[model samples]
Target: MHFHGTEVRQQALTLLRGGSENAEVARRLNVPLGTISYWKHVDRAKRGEPVATRPSLLCPLCHRRPLDDSAYAYLLGLYLGDGHISHYAKHHVPSLAITLDDGWPGIQDQAETALRAVFPHNATCRVRTKGAHNIKVYFKHLPCLFPQHGPGKKHDRKIALEPWQQEIVDAHPWDFVRGLIHSDGCRITNWTTRLVRGERKRYEYPRYFFTNKSDDIRELFTDTLDKLGITWTHCTRNGNPFNISVARKASVALMDTHIGPKY
Candidate 1:
């Protein structure tokens, strides 16, 4: 009566979704027919259940496939910022969910687009909730791709990238920055009044702010900024160092050209 619970369930789910009959799934996975039925019942979520996917091709680590590093890097930043990877004790498969504000449909589109680009073999779907669209995908290799996936909130633990992931970020720094900004950062105008030759004038300048509770995440942001020759400062409010501001004129100009306000 004992079968590989996790692996068998995953294969069974794939087979069932791929148009295989229950008997066939039980045979292929060497699982009992009644167990397969029970599994299917539990497998479905409220909305948009995922179809079968060949993880070998979809997974960069499991097979020798060409992965879209640029998209991966961008998605990584978003994941570190506002994304969550969840798992159930019984289910082996892990789900990657990125919470994006519904206000900006364009950014949500880009997020889903990037997700599909990286895992072209898998089906990506979005679920709408109050004022936000949760972009999500299911895959076995998600943890392999985003090694930062672990128990507890990211800010509660250390967050660092693997060497290979770092290479991707280094190659596509702007994309990474844009992803972080899109998720946890914003660009706003700051105005001030100055006296110019006995005349009062108002000056407005655009500045970008990236706020995250994780210290390691903020450090990664500043390190990348250094590589891009972008000037940034650590902003503290009420004795907490959790905000990074790109307010310098030249840096803000660079941010405008590359990572403008998310529309």
Candidate 2:
């Protein structure tokens, strides 16, 4: 929660020494911007740089991770699919929110758990809006979890993984795939009517489908599948959003083993 006086000062100093901007430090620590400015001014004076003369008292100082695998990978996948990172100019806060169907409490719990795993310091809260529930994590910056964030729709923007992110994905591709499918994809049994020996017969089969508007995101899904040796088919639907279908029994079995059916 809340940091005070000496603790705040120490944390601010640590961040400042690490070359974090004053505004960033202020936002991250939830301290007043002016406080960071004052600390910076004091530091400058000690460094023999140009500084305004202010009351300098020897006030006591005090003290103060990423989603990579498992829960983190799952969270990342959920974010890439249903979560959104937004910046509020008025409050100067950057927040990440993931909305899930309130009807499914288990899914909401999973989302909250994943968010907590990825951002242990931040508080994860659930809010109900209309018929849906949202699990939100707020912080000072967006890059902490959503490095792929940029201007415009995710589909319209380019999405690429950093080397570290790639490494995580490479190590836990199954979890990553599970997250993606749990958020944006679905597994269902479909029934078809066919003629067998001149008689009408109904057959049922299982299939998994993932849909998104971003080509890059679609590629990421398929590429991950390729690495896992799972078969999938990509096709454009309505000449806008695209979809990937995993219908073969073996592929479906593999996905079931890794991702399973989202509850």
Pairs clashing in candidate 1? none
The reply for model 1, stretches above 4 Å from the true place, is: 1-58, 89-91, 237-240
Each model's lDDT comes to 0.88, 0.78
Give the per-residue lDDT digits (tens) of candidate 2, residues 26-50: 8999898987898888877888888
What is the C-alpha lDDT profile of model 1 across 95-175, one tens digit per residue? 889999988888999999999999887788998888998999888778888889888899999999999999999999999
- Separately for all candidates shown, the number of backbone clashes (residues 3 or more apart, or on different chains) is 0, 1
Best by lDDT: 1
* Residue 4, model 2: Cα distance from true site in angstroms: 16
Candidate 2, residue 98: lDDT: 85
